[model samples]
Target: VVVVVVIVVIVVVVGVVVVIVVVLGSNGGNVVVVVVVVVIEVVLVIVVVILLQVVL
Candidate 1:
């Protein structure tokens, strides 16, 4: 459980950094894309947590 949580945290951190870089590189032009990406990421994380709970 601890290992899974640590991995998830690391992935989320990397994803956030990538998203930030993308948004800044686009100069705010892709605001909609960014929102969609964020929503997708959140959903994926939720799904993973749910699966983990079920399995554990």
Candidate 2:
């Protein structure tokens, strides 16, 4: 149980960090694309957590 929680936390933290870095590092060209990317990342994180819960 502890290990599962730790893995989930790590995954979430890493996903958030990646999103932040990408958003901050990108040049200003398409705001819509940025928003879409952020939304996709968030959805991916949620899916990962849900899958983890189901597996554990």
Winning candidate number (lDDT): 1
| Candidate 1 lDDT tens digits, 1-56 | 77777877887787788788887788656777678778877977997789798988
Which RMSD does model 1 reach against the true structure? 2.6
**lDDT score at residue 22, model 1, on the 0-100 scale:** 84
**Prediction 2 TM-score vs. true:** 0.51
Pairs of residues clashing in candidate 1: none
Error of 1 at 3 (Å): 0.6
C-alpha lDDT of residue 43 in model 1:
78
TM-score attained by model 1: 0.61
Clashing pairs in 2: none
Off by over 4 Å in 1: 27-40
The local distance difference test score of each candidate is 0.79, 0.70
